[model samples]
Structures are given as structure tokens and as C-alpha cells.
Target: MWKKPLKPVTKKAVKTKLILLYEDIVCDGTEGCKRHKLVGKKYFGGLYEGSERNEDLWLEVQQYIYDNYDTEYLKNVYIAGDGAPWSVAGCRVLEKSKFVLDKYHLGKYIYKATTHLDDSQQAAKEFIYGAINERDFDGVMRLLQKCYASTDQEYKKKEVTECARYIKNNWLGIMVRIDDGGAVWGCSAEGHISHVLSARESSRPMGWSKKGVDWISHLRVLTRNEQKIIDLMEYQDKKQRKKNRIECEDQLIQDVQKRKSSRNEEVLRKAIPGLEKKQFSWMRSIINAGGIIA
Candidate 1:
């Protein structure tokens, strides 16, 4: 359940203030389908698009953290996710967080690069892996360039370029893992998404609505972080007692329902326009007021 913390790297720019790592995928129930397709496979359902579901989930989680925790909780934040646009978008949306590419996705690119290489080239593959594992960005790029340049038109240079570009764009994040002494490896998020959605995908049909996937996935995240639920319940119980002292049963019930359904920042902004003074000060206060618990 616990992983090592990433070590800070030597960088001129101030590191991100908070790091959020997550991954997501659509699940269609199938046992062992070659592709994500199956005969009569029912689509597992959820919100928006499956990708958007992932984004929204991250946003909700981030908001919760920001609301309940100290702003200084994280000096520099790193968000890690797979290559999916939803994951990428979530990272991009964070005001002060840096997005790190998932190492597993980078591995996929490496495998693709060596797919046609000979068994004798296992050493080359190992070398590439070492560079990535060490978070040696320059080393990785050098190796890739050499691999591409030496090949006799066997591999597409463009493919190599695309992969290299990904690594370059995400170089800092990838190095964070390496520089941190491997403390911040992103396998947790990858494992989370895989464990949550893999079995469901293998068995269910495809083309599910995004909302269905999100609700189920959110449940999975909730189950995994049971302490969060307990805290919310406790907070809600306290709030209920306070409300009971001053309100009737029907009004209390309605208030609870409203708190439950309308805990988001935007909703609160509209409800109490004055709270929007600082970036998210009102939002944080509302969350601290146990809006999230409901």
C-alpha cells in the first residue's frame, strides 16, 4: 500500500507543488479476447466519455485533497498517467502540477522499437531498458538515435522519432522517478487501473457510456481508499447532529441530499458567490464544512 517517496532532482525551475498520478481504461467483459472485442459483449457503463470519466475523477480527487489539506501539503506535484488523452488532460489541467509519463507506456514504445530486432540484439534492448530505468534522458535519446541510424530501413525512423518526442516532452517526469531513487515510480496508478478494469473488460461488451464506467471506477477507488469513506461518514454524522439541533427531519434529509449531490466547486461557487474571493478559498471552506462527506 505504501511506496517510497521520489527524491527531488536538481532543476533550476521550482518543482511542481503537488503530484497526482492516475490511469484509466474502458472495460468490456470478456475472458481472454485478443482485442477489446467480444461476441455479444455488453459495455460496462459510466459518465461523459470513458476518457472524460478519468479526467473528472482526477479533478474530483484533486478538489477533495485541496479542500481538506493544507496548500503547502505538496511543494511540487507530479501527475503520472498512461498515454491516454484523458490522463494527459488531467495532468495538464492541474494549475501547479507536472505531468509525468507512465514508465509502462514507455516500455511499450521500447518493445515496439525492438519488435523486429534479432535475438542477438537482446543486448541492445537491455541497453535501452537500462537507459530508461536509470532515467538517463540523454542516454535514452542517444541509444534510440543510434538504433534508428544504424538500421538498414528495417525500422521506420518516424516511429522512432515519435517515441523520442514523447520521451523528450516528458523527460523531466521520467527522470523524476530515476532521480528520486525510484521512489516515485508510476506503477501504482497503472496497477490500479489494470486491477480495477481488466477483469470487467475481459467479460463485458464494448461501447459502454462514459458515466457507467466512471461510477464503477469511482466505486473501485472508494473501496481501495476505505479510510476516505470512513472520514466522510464521520464528518457527515457530526454535521447531521448539528443540523438536527436546529432543523426538522424533512429539511435535514433534503440538506443531506443536497450536500451529497452538489459538493463540487462550481456548484458551491454558484450557491455562495462571495466565497469565490481567492482561487478556490470558498471551495476549500465548503469542502472543509463537510460538503464532501455528505
Candidate 2:
């Protein structure tokens, strides 16, 4: 589920919206494939205006997977998201999957803690990303402690404390390799949201209705699936044909209900109470000729 942050627009500053983009990628599973060659991807999403209900959000995720992902082939699942409570709920629904604390969020918190350090920020980053602290979360906390002790400012201390608590809570997910067994955790939500969702939906002053936003979100995903463009075009053509057929049927039904004389009568006759025969003929002549008599 690719849910981008709710952005406010001119129409309603307090009302925010989210677009849940459907996304999945297949890679070569062959042992000697050399690289994980991307085979295929499905990208689609719908905009949900206002906050979704708790049950609806989970239901949305289930529907997203059933529609897009092949559960039979989903073996090595690695769920990732920002450290939001709502995000953690996503990991719980999947069985036997590793929940990776998005490195992006981790880095963001780290930056907040170390921003006051200026030059020392790079060192702090290295300390966080280092493989030596693979399972050593205490070591990570100790580094936070070091930052806390060095700072006299309350704001800096608060940042450090927040980061410390975040790390401690998600320490299970903080490892590049859990128990250092060579398996890696991964996430790309921050990158995808920035480049795909935010770039299109939230970068402007435009506001959207439920229908308008949904159509735009779906179109954005469709644009990226170049391989499926032909299929999409063919599908749209079928829809157009169906629409034409339905419209024809409706028009036929309407015609059956109306008398031919009513259809043939000049609507302008009732518009004037006392027009001379000469004026009526002149106007009718112009209507038939499709020209201005004046």
C-alpha cells in the first residue's frame, strides 16, 4: 500500500487526502541471475479523502494485495514503513515477514538529533549505518547518550531522547542483518512517495474531489507501466464502445417516447407571442440555411 502523506490545498486547508498507490515488482529468482533483473511491476492507487477508518485501512491493504500481488510467489516478505503506529500495523497482518524500520525514517530522526552537532553529523550517520552495530542497539543508545551529554540545549536533548526511544522500540527492525545471518532488511517508501506520489499529487495548489483525485492517482500509476500501455488503451476503447452502445439505446428509448411532430416542430414558434408570418419565415429560413439573416 503506497499511502502518501495528506496534503492541504486551497479548497480546504484543514482537509487532507491520501493516495494509496498499488505497487509490486518481480525479480529474477534464478540462482545465477547475477542481478535481480526486474521482470514486471503493477502500479496503481486510489485517493482516499479524509482519514480512513481503522478497519477500512487494513481492509484496503488486503484488497491491494489480492488485486496486485500473487500470494503464491510471495516468499521473502520484507515489510517497511516509517515509525508510525499505523505503519506497524501493516507488518502484523503479514505472517513470517521481517519489519524493517525504514532507513529513511531512521536517518531522519538521526539527523534531528545530530543537526545541532553540525560537522559531527557525518560521524553520527556513520555510527548508525555501520555494520559493527548490527545487533548492538545498546551501542546505538550509548551514542545517543554521548550526544545528549555533549548538548546543554534542551531542544537538542529532546531530539536525542526521541531518537533514543525510537531506536529502542524498533531495535528489532534496526538491524541490517538480524542476528548477522546475512539476510538484509529493506524499504523504499520515502523515495517512492517523494518521487512518485508527492511529485504529482501534492506539489501543486490544486484541490480535488473524491472522484477527481482518484482518477488522477490511477492515471499517474498507469503512466509508469509502459509495458501495459497497449493493454490499457485497448481496455479504454472497449469502455468507449460500451458507452456509445448504451447512449444509443438511451436515445432510442427517448425517441420511442416522443412523437415525430414534437421533434420536427420549430422551438422558436413558442418564443414569440405575435410574430408576423414574414418574420417566422425569415427566422426558419436562417435556421435551415444555418446562416445569419440580419
Candidate 3:
């Protein structure tokens, strides 16, 4: 989805995209092919931006799989998407991978193509799915052509043509279900997009800069993976402080001395009854104990 940028008002909003990858073990309907049982480990990917972003994301995915999963035992990997070229290209990066058409998009096109056939809509859907199962791309086109011819409305004809083209282009993805003997249960990309990315990015009516979107995407993924952002920030802060320990120590000393010499000290002494009597001993104690280093 496109989101408005934070600068250069004249420049158009950039397209923000999120890629998600996961492993699943389908039951083939034997072990009660329920929905929740199919999903395995999931990992959310980052936004693809630069010229080689696609390759970058794929390389990261490959590395992640190798590091976390046992590749030696993996036989086949199914990559399901809405027939986009980028999605189809994933098969080239990962070995033994097959493209499967996400059923959500397939069903959407099917509804558009057959919704005009009122009474025969169900029958037309069944016919289209059967033809897809048989890998008969031409047959599917013929049926769509007939549907187009039967429709008098220009809009209906357009829908049929668009559906036909989508099916023709994604024919292999559609047939993968049959080729894999129904093991490819389908893709839940839309669901994941809604739950993970959209919840923070697009669900509300706010605009986001490209970098802002990228940062939030990583944060969301880290959260999904159960990583604590606070912990990460603390670690980085500690690392930075360690790198500039001498500089930080000098800055802290200067700030403490400045505070000690400030005219506001008398105001604070009067504001609190025990201020002068305590003599800022807490600060001295902290400095002596090395408590301010962190």
C-alpha cells in the first residue's frame, strides 16, 4: 500500500510493502486437516526498497531458513502468492520450491468472473475450478470467453476478460494444488498482512515516511518474534556509552559541576527544607559509587 511521505509535499507517497514467510506441515486431510494445525514457524520480512531490495529480502530469507530450519530433511517448499512476478521469482532463490496461487485471490477472481451468471454462478465456479484442477488453461479461457460473450454489460465483459487473464497467467500456481495432491492448503497472506503490518501501518488514517514504515516493520517483526524493544535499546545505549566512555564521563562531570554552580540551587534549597542540610549528598554518593556510569 502507498503511504504519504513526511517531507517534500509535492512528491508522491511511496509504496510500502511487507513480505512474510513461514513453514507449514499440512496433513493432507488424514490427520484432521484443520486450519490452525497447518501453520508452523512464521517470520516476518522487512520492506523492500532499493533497486536490489527483492534480492536482498530473498537472501535474508534463505539465510534465516538455513540458520533456523533443518534444510537437509526438507524435500519441497511451497511459495504461495497472488501471482505477482516478485512472488513467483522466489522459487528461483530457494531450491525445490513450487509456486501456488493464493486461494484468496483466486476466489476473488472467480467471484468476479461468475457473479454475472446469476443462476449459473455456482455451476460456473465448479466448472472453472475443475478446469484449473485439470490444468486446462485453454478450457478455462473458453469458459471465460463464453461468459464474456453471454454478458451484454460492458463491465461484465471486462470482469470476465480480467479473470481469464489472471487465470492464464497464474495457471501453474492454480494447478499446483492438484499437482501436490491437495497438500498446498492455500496462503494466508492477506490475514498475515492485516494482522501484522496493517494493524500499525495502514489501519489508521495517518501517513508514514518510507524510513518510518521500514523502522516500524522491523519493530513489529521483533515484537512478533518476542524480542523486547526496551532490551534492544538498552543494549545499544550501553554499547554506545562504552564506545565513548571518556567523553561521557567528561560530559557528566561538566553537567554536575554546572548544576552545582547554578543560581537555581539556592531556590531549590529554599523549596525543600532539608536541601542545604543534605548538601546534595545523594549526588556525591552516586559519583563515588560509580552509579552514574550506566
Candidate 4:
């Protein structure tokens, strides 16, 4: 019988680390654009809230765009976002960046429409995709409107109507590749938010301060940049070492001062002969006289 070899098993402690998700957009003919490259910027909070956050995010995004992409690519910058007004406003800042509504948000409305429909649910689903893919923005609106008008039930009508208006308001954004000269790609914001950010930041029974959220998100983003995270950890370690060194020096100084004081007292005692004797003699005389401390 041949002896069997056992494989080694390793146990490691659970360490908390920031997680990041990014879209891998293929780049071409540039040093920065080597291949299918991952591009991402870390951010926390809504762009609509607070001051200058949206502006700052755009600065990072635009810089990334310019570096890895051609000038013509800049002219056809496809900015994919959801139905948020802030997403719209953020797109406007980039002169050439065209705003495209995320298809995933629209898909939610499609699913919502299916639930309320009493019949022909499959047909409704197919038609929604067909219209959107055909770049027939008005067709989509019209189809949803027809869904609304045909439904006599008040509740269904309201749901269908809202769905229609969602497509209507985001008309330009809905059909970016077909309407404007933009890239053909899917938006991965859903995965990015849920799996990437929420998994680390918000998916637990915990809360975070604004600055805390921002700092952690930044750590995630830096890790994606490769070797940057190591540099950051090393830098922090150096700071901690320096702090410990300063504290040790401070303690040594205090210890030295105490030793010097004790040595000076001994030296004084030795230098001043009969000092202890005189002190004891005064106390003894007072005790002998039976004088009270007062």
C-alpha cells in the first residue's frame, strides 16, 4: 500500500478591508489605455447634498477620461447615471459628456408594469425592450401610456402612468447610444453600490459619519490602483513608529530629570556637612521642650 500525503491547511484571522467595484472599459492605442482597463473613483453621500462634492468627483472622472482616452473620445463622453437630478446636473458640467439614463432603473419600471398587468405580461416585457433598443423613446412612452389608458383600475393606472413619465422625462438620457454618438456599454452602478460600497459600509447594523464614510471609500479606491495601498499602509506605519519614538524619548527625558534631581539632593547633602544633624538637633530640642506644633 502506498502512503498518502496530507495537504496543509492554513488558518487566517478575518480582517476588514474596503471593497471597490469598477467598470472595465476597453481602451485603445495609448499608454494609459493598454487594454480592458478598470476605471473607478470612490465617493460617499449623494451628489445633490452638500457643497462642491459633485464638482470634485467630476474633476477626477474627467481627468481619468482625458488621460486614457483620445480627444474625440472626450467629445463623445457617455455619462451613465440613474434618474437622480444630481446625476443630470453632474453630466451638464462636462461640456461634451452626454447623459444617459441607466437602463437598470428603467428595467425596474418594466418589472413594475408586469406585476400590475392582468394579462399579456410577457408581451409587455418584450415590447418595452424592443422599443428602448430601437431608440424609440416616444414609442416606449406611448406604450406605457397605452398601458395606463387601457387600465380602468385606478391603482394600475397610477403605476403605469408614473412608468411612462419616467421614460418621458429622461427621453434624451434613455437612448444615448442611438440618439447621441456615445459608447455602447452597460452601466454597472447597481453592482458597484450594492456589492462594492454597501457590502463594506452600509450592509451591516452600523452607521458612519460623513467624513468616516468618505475616508473608507477613498481607501477602497486607492487599493484598486495597485501598490498604492501598500504605500499608504507603510506611510501610516512610519507615523506610528515616529509617535512611539517621540513618546520613548519623552519618557527617557523625564526619567533622566528625576535621576538628576535625586543625585543633586545627595550631592547637596554631602556638600553641606551636619545638615541632617542640625535638622535632627532642632527637632529634638523642640520635642525635649514639649512644645506643641502650634
* Models, CA RMSD each: 18.2, 12.2, 14.1, 14.6
lDDT of 2: 0.62
Weakest ten-residue segment in model 3 by summed lDDT: 1-10
lDDT of 4 by residue, 178-210 (tens): 566444576667565665456666576555554
**What's the lDDT for all of these models?**
0.55, 0.62, 0.72, 0.61
Tell me the spans in candidate 1 whose CA falls farther than 4 Å from its real position.
Answer: 1-56, 92-96, 129-139, 149-159, 181-183, 202-207, 222-294
Superior by TM-score: candidate 1 or candidate 2: 2
In candidate 1, where is summed lDDT lowest over 10 consecutive residues?
37-46
TM-scores, all models, native as reference: 0.49, 0.57, 0.71, 0.58
Best by lDDT: 3
True-vs-predicted CA distance for residue 62, candidate 2, Å: 4.6
On lDDT, the stronger of 1 and 3 is 3
Model 3, clash count?
Answer: 0
Per-residue lDDT tens digits of candidate 2, residues 140-161? Answer: 7788888899889998999999
Return the TM-score for candidate 1, rounded to 2 decimals: 0.49
What candidate 2 gets wrong by more than 4 Å, as runs, is 6-39, 47-74, 130-132, 176-186, 209-211, 222-294
